[model samples]
Target chain A: MNVFLQELRSQRRSTLIWSLSLAAFGSLYLLLFGAIRNDISAFEDVLKNFPPVAQAALGFVIGTLKTVSGFYAFAFTYIVLCGAIQAANLGVGAIGREIGGSTADFLLTKPRARWSILAQKALAVLVLLVATNVVLLAVTIPVAAAQGPDFDAGLFVLLSATMFFVQVIFASLGLLYGVAAKKVKSVVAVSLPGVFAFYIVGLLGAVVGEDAIRYFTPFKYFDIGYILKNAAYETGFCLVAVAVVVVAVGASFAVFAKKDVQAL
Target chain B: MNVFWRELRANRKSLIWWCVGMVLMIYAGMAKYAAYATSGTSIADLMKQMPASLSAALGFAGLDVMKASGFYGMLYLYLLLMVAIHAALLGANILAKEERDHTSEFLMVKPASRSRIVTAKLAAAFVNVTVLNLVSLGLSFAVVEQYAAGENMTDEILLLMGAMFIVQLVFLFLGSAIAAVGKRPRSAASLATTVMLVTYVVSIVVDINKNLGFLRYLTPFKYFAAAPVLDRMGYEPVFVVLSALIIVASVVVTYLAYDRRDLKL
Candidate 1:
């Protein structure tokens, strides 16, 4: 319990920074929608000229370009990218700090079991990611509502909720990398490429119009267009996402428990 | 000189990984182009479907995707991103690792001046970026011949490579400057990554909306946009000079700050 609280307390500042930044980022996009709402038709016409591949790559849907909700969804793609990076950073850094800071020995010397420590760290990360989502929703929801009373409040909530799901996936992946890699010199080094590679894969899947490829990248787990139309996630992809998090996090705990801590 | 060699050796493995990663990415993207070219998917049909705003935002404004140069122009977006991240990571890691790994005191006591140490480290990083760029370019030339479409794309390819090199240098220096200016030397690579992401987002935002056109001057990604480079077969003199100025200013700042700042160790 002390380990959990300490880890949580230590992470508070960064969690706050990431949450505030994400809120500000989402708010900025929502604010931009106001400027664009009046000129949506003009914007749609402009968007209509885009190549299908390009549109797919950017997650832009012409059908949704005219509505504030549609525009928000478009902007939300990039926001999710940012949030994924934040979560990946947190996930990697959680275990990475112990290894990179050469404090794994110090941590291991405690009376608690390694599984307990891992659980506490994982809990800290989950709490922080949850808090981040709450702050993001707090800022985005009211601003989205202000756009117009007709804004689909339920759909907007559903769309925003995907960010948490995506974060969990990336966070688990990060934890795997943290435990699996021989040494992580920088958390950004590990997470940036991981996040971008998956993102690019998602973009390429869009360009290729390949449904199978979509299942491979977490960035495509929740399609805003599908969600807006069906008002729900693709059950298969959601299950795949949950499976990934569970397997990866489970493997990380197993590997980290037995892994030898290198003396600095 | 020993510092330079040490930096080079330390970065050797990652350099090879980056080179291999970039080569594979280019190969994969170009292979897709081959499919796009031979497939019945009409280039014009695809172009007509794309909106002007999206095309411009993606740096796809002027190129005809059917042509090799145009295709390369489109691929340049991904290449630029890969190279920028590589260069920035190299620059940040080279400078910040001493403090990060708690080896600052050992290095500080060496028979070398801080300025010389900084120069050697920066030089080593520059060399790594240069090697990665050259290898990728070589691999691209070899792969591009397989699907050249009979157009002379050599000049445009060279120009684009030059622009990428400049972009890499800009980010490299920017990363160094960030490391130099940071007080505690914590996660300089993360800082560099964030800066790159912000600039990239700004570049895309500016391209998507004409109202934000003024922001084009801020991001290094826009400094050598692919369309303009392909059309002109060269970069704009203003952006080129501006990039040079920024690089020079960043290097200068890195030197001054690194020389004066107290090492945490």
Candidate 2:
């Protein structure tokens, strides 16, 4: 319990920074919606000329750019990309930082068991991610509601909720990378490329229109277009996402429990 | 001179990994292009459905996707991203590693002046960027020759590679400047990556909205927009000069600060 509080306190500043940054990002995109709302047709005309594959690659849907919700969905793609990086940073750095900073020995010398320490740290990270999402939603929901009275609050909430799911998926993967790698020299070095590779894969899947490839990238798991039209996530993909997190986190605990802590 | 050799030796493993990663990325893109190329006009028709602004935003607005040069032009965005990250990491890590790894005391006690150390480190980083660019150039040419449907696009390919080299130089100095200016440098690589990402987002925003056009001046990514480079086979002279000034300024700042700043160790 003390370990969990310590981890949370230590990560508080970064969590606040990331949450504020993401909120600012969301607000900026929502503000832009006001500027272009009146001239949406002009924006549509611009989008209409884009090739189908290019449009898919960009996560833009035609005929939908006119509405505040649709435009927000389009801008949300960038938000998710940034959000993934933040989560990955937190996840990778959670365990990796102690080892990388040569402080693992100090932590390990404590009376607590390794599993307890890992659990506390992982729980702290989870709490931070949840806090970030709460702040994001609290800020974005009112701003989105201000766009129009007709705004589908429920659907908007649903769409924004997907960010948390995606973050969990990346966070678990980052945890795996943190434990599995021989040594993590720099968190960003590992996380940036890892996130971008998945992002590019998502883009490629869009361009190729391959349903199977969509399964590979977390960014595609939500399918905003389908969510907007159907008002729900694909159950199959959600199940896969859950399975991934469980396997990755379970493996991390097992490996970390048995692995010898390297002396710096 | 010793510092230069040591930096190169230390960086060799990472350099190889980066080179291999680039090769795999290019190979993957080319392999995808081969399928598109062999599919005839159907793929082009599908591409034509993309909006003009979307195409422009992607930096491949008006090119023939079937042509090897055009395809390479499209893939240039990803390549630019990889190279920029490489350059920034190199610049940030070269100087900052001494402090981060707690080895500055040993190096600082050496006979060489701080300026000499900076020059040697910078030289090593420059060499790494140059070598990586060359490898990319060689591999790109090889791929085009093997898969191209028309005449060799040697000039077009070379021009794009040159532009990427300039981009690398710009980011390299910027990274060095960030490291130099830090009071207690921790995670210089992450700081550099944040700068790169913020600028990239700014560039994309500028592309999406005409009202935000002035934001283009803020990001290095905008300075070398791929479409103009692919279509005109040249960069805007203004941006080129601006990039040079940025490089020169960063280099000057790095020297002055690094010389005066106290080592954390």
Best by DockQ: 1
What is the per-residue lDDT of model 1 for residues A147-213, given as tens digits with 9 covering 90 to 100? Answer: 8767888888899899999999999999888987877778888888788778767655434656977
Whole-model Cα lDDT of every candidate shown, in order: 0.82, 0.82
Ten-residue stretch with the least lDDT total in model 1 chain B: B50-59
Error at B229, model 1, angstroms: 2.5
For all predictions in the order shown, the interface RMSD in Å is 6.2, 6.2
How well docked is model 1, in DockQ terms?
0.25
Model 2, runs deviating above 4 Å: A33-60, A64-67, A148-150, A201-212, B30-71, B144-152
Docking class of 1: acceptable
Over B1-265, each residue of candidate 2 has an lDDT whose tens digit, in order, gives 9999999999898889788878777776777787767656644654565555544433466676777778887788778888888898789878888887778999999999999999999999999999999999999998877778666788888888998899899999999999998775667888887798788778767766667878888988878776677777888998899999999999999999999978888
